[model samples]
Target chain A: MNIISFLNILLPFGYAVAVYAYGKAFFADTPWAKSSKRWILLSVIGTHIVYLAARTTAFSHPPATTVYEVLTLLAFTTSAAYYVIESRTGNRETGYFILNIPFFFQLVSSLFIKDLLEVPEILRSNYFGFHVTAALAGYSAITLSAVYGFLYLMLYHEIKQTRFGAVYRKLPSLENLERMSVMAIWLAFFFLAAAMLAGVVWLPQAFSDFSYADPKLIGTVFIWLLYGAALAARRSTRWKGRKMMIVAISGFVISIFSLTAVNMLLSGFHRFN
Target chain B: MNLLCLSISHHTAPVEVRERLWLSPEEIVKTLPETLRLGCSEAVLFSTCNRTELYAVTDGRLPHESLIRELIKQKNAGSVVHESHFSVYRGPEAAGHLFRVASGIESMVLGDVQILMQVKEGYQLAVNAGTAGFFLHHLFPSAFHTGKRSRTETTIGTGAVSVGYAAVELAERIFENLRKKTALVIGAGETAKLTAKHLRGKNIGSLTITNRTQNRADQLARVLECSTIPFDRFRESLADADIVIASVRVDTHILTADDVARALEHRHTGALFLVDIGVPRNIDPAAGKLENVFLYDIDTLTAMVDENVHKRRAQIPAVERIVADELHSLELWHASLQSTPTIQALTAMMETIRKGEVEKNINRFGEKDRELVELVTKRIVNKILHTPIAYMRNGHDAGPTERLLSVNVIRRIFGLDHDNAKRDDDA
Candidate 1:
């Protein structure tokens, strides 16, 4: 197989091993697993970077040209976002929870992905690249917030219920999880806002069929507003611990629905399937 | 040569007796040099609240009892603890003892996080006193390696193993930074004071203590150097607290579900961590059911402490295996030290015999013939010694104990053991 195909196969395989390594380190605390997990994750990230650059250069258009290609890029950006978080916090305990998303995303993307030899000239626009990158970053941040929210809730339940089992033993503290989730939500808001700004400024000028009332655009804006109000709301009426976590999770659900249903069912210039 | 560890610990002696044998830093400095005069080559003493272990490397000139007697005499602990309270481990067993102590398997509290540091301090004391030498130089690092491995490889050192730290742990579980959080301590009882101390150890931002009697609350606040709220105003202050430790000695619940729910309504805090460690329990059970309110009574904290202790206990076998592996590695390295001295002694004996015969026969020959006889005799001894030296160099597969035995065999075979040679001479 060519380098791209080999990387396509290696992406899921590499991530699977990293997941296992991180899981073993978290549960069993094996010496080898604890030592090797970070290096394995680093190698996988390196390979993923190479694969993305190669795929763009090989196809004459960026991977964001199609939904399937964007899935592959999403997988990369999500894992990349997690890498940044893990590196900064010096905590590798939550990697298994985070890496599983990209693992599955890459698996699906690799299976259905096609080589697009021809594309519209606008697909090569630097504005489109910025818009897609910002959108992917926004989605990745949303995924991080959702995962941290889920972990926060699990640990919260474990503490409140007095189980004090694996969820309590392994996961980060509720306060830390809350901070991470809020930070991610704030990050997602800015990125999605930027993506929307790019779309508004360029879509009306570039495409003949571009409409201001596209379903995808409306859905993204709705997600952006939901998180925006939650993060920026008043202190006395503000959502903090449990209420804030639930809002973050719900926002992620809405984003997923927008990504899947709105793109598949609705017709618009945003749908590039 | 032998490395010996003489231990008087909580396991073998009561705390009253162990305390009598405990050595202060000044006492250890004064007593450490006396070990060398007592016929030991090297010495290190681990004297903590629970254990007082004296590690010495002796040349088998002094018996273990005399060393034990000297230690007991040094402490003036004759009437306090009998000699039987001391547990003696020699050779590899002594190395194993040091490893277990460093790894916290022999600690009174299952995973003694501070014991490793204590071990380091003991080793450092020996180093400063110029007591530890060749053998200890290798053995203590192995013990340290064992300690590090046990902590990293197993979950022994993780979690709050002490029941008293449950409140602090729960606070940590809820909040990211304790420096930004405020804790309201209800009541001035012992449990409340202890919980306050625990929070203080974590450096809580603000501490507001309340008691039924305002004077007692002021006294405790002064001691802890925090503020005090009136007993009646404590409920109002609850809305501002991120953590409420209700350890009041009350017959009825001080915090009810309604009170907590009302506080949470006005609170923009992370979560309400209620640690009720009072007799007759201070917080209502229904308070735990409220959203964003986590109430842990004494029973729950005790249960978590018990489980954490069990988790640490379960890691003992793994830790022991690490100890054994490191001890074996050390012994093998020590066994390698054995061959060099043995080879030198053997060669010296052979050379002595060769020189004596050549001197007696030199007059019977010419000068040139005498030189020829000397060269022939030296070559013959060299050929005889080659096999044993080669065997010693190539014997890496020998296990720890077996390697030591093999070294003994070589000594006995070459008559390098002084005791055997003296015995043979007397016969």
Candidate 2:
């Protein structure tokens, strides 16, 4: 029996089980449910490691070519980001749902994208790899921020209706959610700035276009500007609580569309290859 | 139940009542026995500056007023009991109230921690007294677990909210090296003590404690490894102090802007951190506006606490889900207890009947030995209970007849009565 084939299938199956276990520990009323959640998280991380390793062996490159590779990478980075944040705060379970969202996107991408697509010669440069990797990491981090933003919105909505306000009691407090979102955004902003800079540095020599006038590039810059404004507002203690969350979410939404829909429709460097 | 929550809390009563009801360690030991003898099955008394609650679980199921009256009478006979400042809850309501209290839901600041551990300690005291029985044991543990789950699942306890913590955070934000700074804490009140403790934890050196009650100041100094100054010499010590936390409730200002300016003249240009936790503003507000002097009042800390409360309030759903899940698990176990005995008794009766029938059949084999007889009996019993046990184990025994017969059918069909066997399962 070939070990590589077995692991490729097993890892995704493990991810599914991990996701199910997460749901169980989060929702089910049992004695050792917490322990179960810890185990599930460990399993996901473990399986993801194996999955990445196998894909590396098969493709002979860092996993970021097709939609499947991008989705998996995105999910892994998102989950990893949340894991660090949650561990720091001792909120191991609140981030579980946020972490699993990428898995859904990955599963869909895996089903559609054919395996072993040939890499374009133009995309073979080291700058291409660096730019793509950084951008994906930035997007993943922003995705986590968006998750927190959604949680804040949900909490805000619930508090408005007195009867449904009980669930708000279960989440991290509004300030904590805001902080989590801001942290994610700021971290992503750093990576995004680096990625944009790398792309700019690569453009004149690699693509002969010095200006980042491409729709995807412009959209990313807009996101960067929006987040920079948010950071400045946060420092001044003005655009913090709810307003900050809404802006962060809107910026992330634009980034998402720019990277996916806009990239597909209009010509851009990063697209669903 | 005898649940008297005689509390001089931030709610129901003021700080004056709390101070009056506050019992020292010696007073607690003296009052415990009397409190217990007054029909209180268990008593856990908490006397903090924010609240002083006497949570007692008792065997009496009378009205809340009667319970309170009884508790007051019992406690009054031994020590002075302030009946006007008491609140009472009974049974489930009392349990739920305590749970909420421990969970920080009923806190004046809404999600201010420090109550849960106090509640745990109170429960432990009751346990140590051998007064905690079924209800108190289950209830207290549940309360503690709920509190743990709430903090773990949410960000209810985040941010530097308390005045002491805010002071530390601000200090760290400024100089970052508290080890070199001299922190002088004024007053021997709870706030001052807490602030000193926070400062001490940060490795601040050269602590100078000065209180109106010099002995109290001396005691605090000894405990915190700080130097105690006479209250009259406080102004003299302020010249070299890097950080001053004024926590006394003085009618008039202790450190005016002029005194602060003079102190600034004497002190280095590094920084002067002043935290005024006193309600009447121990340090002049204008003192903070001075060059190289940062001042914060009790309101600044209160605002931080409010903001944290807002954050924790948002985490309510996550905490609630955890509590609700645990409660459901408890209910499932409770339901399992209701049906388990019936299932066991029914299975046992079937085995007994099977053995009897096997013996009767073995009589036909008069020449057979005891080995054959035992083997045949085992086979027959297994055959009889196999289907029903399987169904019950698989959670498929759905019919009313099965439910009724599981308890009664085995008895009627096999002539198994209470005299044959007695149930050993109490739960």
Residues A1-273 of candidate 2: C-alpha lDDT, one tens digit per residue: 355455545555655766666566565533465567666666777677777777667656667777777777776777777776777656554645675676676566556544564676556566876787788878888988888888877765543232223344356655567778888898789889999999888867776544567888888999999899888866764455567888878978898788778878887544556
Per-residue lDDT of candidate 2, residues B192-220 (tens digit): 99889999999997789999999999999
Task: Look at candidate 1 and give me any clashing residue pairs.
Answer: none
Per-candidate TM vs. native?
A: 0.90, 0.46
Q: Distance from true position, residue A21, model 2, in Å?
A: 4.3
The parts of candidate 2 lying over 4 Å away from their true place are A1-4, A21-31, A122-125, A160-166, A203-211, A268-270, B1-427
Worst lDDT run of 10 residues, candidate 2 chain B, spans B392-401
Candidate 2 share of real interface contacts: 0.00
Docking quality (DockQ) of candidate 1: 0.74
Clashes of 1: 0
Write model 1 residue lDDT over A1-273, tens digit each, in one string: 899999999899999999999999998877799899999999998999999899889977778998778888888888888887777666688999999999998999999988888998889887888899899989999999999999998998888778877888778788788877887888899999999999999888898999879988999999999998898772547478888889889999999899889888888888765
